[model samples]
Target: MTTTGTTSKQREQATRKTGSQSGQPIVAGVRSDLHTMLLPMFAEQNEIHDLETVIDGCRIRIRSHDAGVRIPTFMDQKIMMLLAAHIRDVIQSGGQPTRHINIDRREVIDLIGGGGSTGGSDYRRVTERLQRLHSTKITAETAISADVSRRRHFSWIDAFEEDILHTDKGKEVIGLKISLSVDAFRWITQGDGFDMTRERFKSITSAQSSCSRIYAICLANLIYAKGEDVYIQIEDLRLRVPSADTLKGFKKRPLSKAIELISASPDMSRYLSVSLVRKTEDGFIPLDGRAPLESVYIRVCKGPDALPSINKLLPLSETGGDTRSLSAAESLVELLTDRGSSAFTDTEMADMS
Candidate 1:
């Protein structure tokens, strides 16, 4: 299906660029600035799955569309990630944020580390991912304006067109043209949604751990704090990050290990400092110390100026308990999940001090 009501790809002179540069920025198509309004795309091992998560009264839902009764409906996170990388590049490259945009297939393959894979296989995978992105539906219901709750329903991309080359060996993908849906475009255009730094985002491209990338995305939308920190239940975090382990297995090592990796990463440390912790009857304890594992907390430190400013965002206090009405972590969630905008409600801001 073709897109309507907006501009598509304005053909540019195809510039030949080769190879991946380490630490170069990759723009993810579905970035909500640093706020995680959209659910994660996939876990480890390239699993195709469906998931739903709700914060406050808002729901971020993703599901696949399948006509065949025999085929299960799910969105592959790898496809979404690859497509996000391409879309990010296009927008950063000065292309218009219309539904339609063109990218070289080889560039996508290179971006996703498809080296050594056969051309036919690469082409097949890219085609399948595009189809999934086009077919999958995403629905988000949250406050888009003061006093009015809006429900946004749209696909990542409305429709796609590809350039194909047939040779004696097999069919090869030459290029792709895709259109961003109306709702998706609005989300990108609204507020400070696309305000992430390219350097911080590019760090994900070179990092060895996928969880580190997830940590960075989560950090982008976080409320800055000195000591008072943000927390997520281990199970809640497991759902947000893609992993190969079962929920039970993920808790044992992978989750903690991922947080440790982020702590040690220099590229990631530039933006924020993170540690895995658990809250106890006594108080919140760092997992690195001799704390018992119960509720897992991902503690995010104050990030760089590249992130949204404290003046415009909800304040997370450095101290907690009876001294403050709301803990920093609780306030952070309210900032993220309340009105689709990152700022707090008037009453909420009044309660902060």
Candidate 2:
């Protein structure tokens, strides 16, 4: 029937969920049927478009709404690949992933929590070291103006009356300004996208060093996805993360709930901002944080899919078997689900130590 909230073009921007019959995949949406049937009994249950041959083998039905999921732009996806590659490299080198690092900036700031008590001493020292390694400073400014340019024109004024005639006015909606933040991390460099973080660490001697190494690597990636620039204010700085913690085995609470509990404490929330973002077929892009317009400094984008029913998010392999192909949705899900926790959180620092 009728869909609301999006223009025709915007609605059309929504992606198709059905597959073509290539005879290779088990998921029907990826394949096309030799004989096509067009009628009522087409799509899978609770979906708007079946996007496949009405068959029993492989199938997918995508819900059609006036608006569908919006994805990260090309540059962001490139950036995501950079982040993912760096993360994978670190983990492969025997380092703990970012998820495994448990110190918030505050505990990091005050030097208290190392995510738990078991490894507290190790976490405390290592985190302090990492803090010194990746320190950076940033400043951003937003400008406004009332002038029009060659590519822009002022609109004609209408409905002027003698009783209320006055001078017509025009204004600039947004002006370009610069945000100055150091390069704490680089996603793409010199025709290659991987292994740009070697300089951020001091030589990791063991698993402990590796854990801290990966933690810094994770934060470097996390900082970029939030639309913030990562940089090293102090050169030769290193981020230290302890290799051990007792809470590593605990089942995770809902990510949103964790962010809430963290942010609910005014002091704790001040450590970092949290949000849930989506991973696309190409790469992971962060969702924005929830903050008032005037008060936030550094924003941390955290959590998994901002969308519901991630299980249904398109996978590189619609059949849930193999993923040799590229499906943007599938790509994203794999990235965010890598550690099971879907969010990335960081802080607006007073200054990196």
Candidate 3:
């Protein structure tokens, strides 16, 4: 867990160039299922004690280590993405992939844009986030067979061992040997995932607030979307994000603020366009004071700088003969359509936030 001092050769090995450090397009493999369902939108440290809910007919239960720790937030999502990218690189290089992987702590901080300082405060925070990811447990319902249902229980990480290096300056964490839980490993390495550029991942993780980060994550996951416009009901979105904000508050603040941020980013705007819309008897219309806000209309297409790897991530044939790729929004629409309902009851809405 700790080392007295690192030799020059050791330091060189530790800092050797991975795909990310080489300035190549870092393509991160991310679980669409987990990202679209498990992560919370709000970054507030709210302790979740055996919280259980049903999302899209799948029962999900979340439990933190104790009242002192919270479930994985947007920040942890960034860490998971980084780990996924590392694992992908390992597999592509013909290295045997496993649930356990090694990571350089300093390189991680630099990649996620945490801060320039790798001092005690920063290291402590990073370790705390890792512990939180390891301690929080989740059980989700899955269908094992045509008529059989099963519940899978797992955590983001099973455990981690830290490598502390001692220098004349001070003691520092040089690396980590992290073991991903069974479900987490399967989710990341399996074919049911998406690819994202390293720059986009960093841009989102370093976002100023939870709302902005969550919005960026949602948009980035829409890389596979094949339509000109995709409509998502606001109520359904609120539940998917598991946001604490009510419909009015969510629309006025987080949703609106995210739109503004995305619009201001020239690169982001070129790839994805987002706007508010209202539903009426005729069809979907632009948001105005006249009608109530009902849904968000999203248009996602490959920009000039988009990597070719994105197009190959999800093929229509893989999606069970569906002509268009099923983005998170499209998937939610299908679930809602099957249920014949989109609005949540007052009690259900209150419980979600």
Candidate 4:
């Protein structure tokens, strides 16, 4: 039986505020054994036809259905099928999976092809604006405007410099992912490895240091087809884009933590906000079906409330201890909001930097 649960308690504990007073209910807390409800669906689904094999300790079950697998109808079949698919997954793609990464600055480089140009962007102009803002020569608006104009230069590059700007012209949609130690220099110098034991894969390198990772990602998104053949470099760093847009008709292996399975008929997933978590039987449900999932994930987005005691933080809370709830940090933000000109201008950021 496969089981999954929240590894952290940080998800719950919400604090909400109505109007004048902020409520303290604590933010959402990730319940332990969140996998309890999830594992059974995988293990005992009734109609699981292919049960001959097992992999990674999970029983293998594979079957085809005319319509979607109904949870109550083919419970066993679903479980066993999902298990077999899971095994096939391990065998086919290798073991386990890397969930999330620390999103280090180097990961940014890795996205753009570490040892190559960051993007086809004119970093020269961006840098010049930064220098100007730093010396108080121009306003932040001027710098950001310059940056935006420079950004405007980005478009689908024609077949001209396709060979040279291959890495810089688009966002490198990742298909494989791995974690690296938190050293940008070493990670950049020697490059991040796929398999540290045998050094199975070498990281990509970038041609320049000043290139922006965003540009590379945008470019890579356009150019590369799929797989490790498309490599990128930031400086000396190299790595494969480990993400890919989920393919069509691909039945995402049902997750043990999946509490709900919303179909593709008219996906309402995209219409929702990130703060709206799909309360499912599975902890993390897959948005795999004919139509793309456009669901908003809430519940999980606790930090957006920030420290503000009003709308965001308050809504999550029921009742509050006003003294403890009051935030000096949020107070500063509230002051800024009251002042109206809230956004940090590019010039201001550059000057501060």
Give me the candidate number with maximum TM-score: 3
- Indicate which candidate wins on lDDT: 3
Q: Arrange candidates by TM-score, highest first: which order?
A: 3, 1, 2, 4
Off by over 4 Å in 3: 1-53, 142-150, 165-170, 213-224, 293-353
Give per-residue CA lDDT, model 2, range 127-176, as digits (tens). 33332222211111111235521111111011111111112232211111
| Candidate 1, poorest ten consecutive residues by summed lDDT | 6-15
Give the lDDT of residue 338 in candidate 4.
23
Q: Compared with the true structure, what per-residue lDDT tens digits does model 3 show for residues 167-269?
A: 7666756557788875566556543445555565456445555445445434533432332244456655555566667877877776777777776776566
As for TM-score, the candidate ahead, 1 or 4, is 1
Q: Report the CA-based lDDT of candidate 4 relative to the real structure.
A: 0.20
Candidate 2 or 4, higher lDDT? 2
TM-score per candidate: 0.61, 0.18, 0.71, 0.15
Model 2 stretches astray by more than 4 angstroms: 1-192, 197-207, 210-214, 227-244, 248-353
Against the reference, the lDDT scores of all candidates come to 0.48, 0.24, 0.55, 0.20
Backbone clashes counted, model 1: 8
Clashes of each: 8, 32, 1, 96
Candidate 2: worst-modelled 10 consecutive residues by lDDT:
31-40
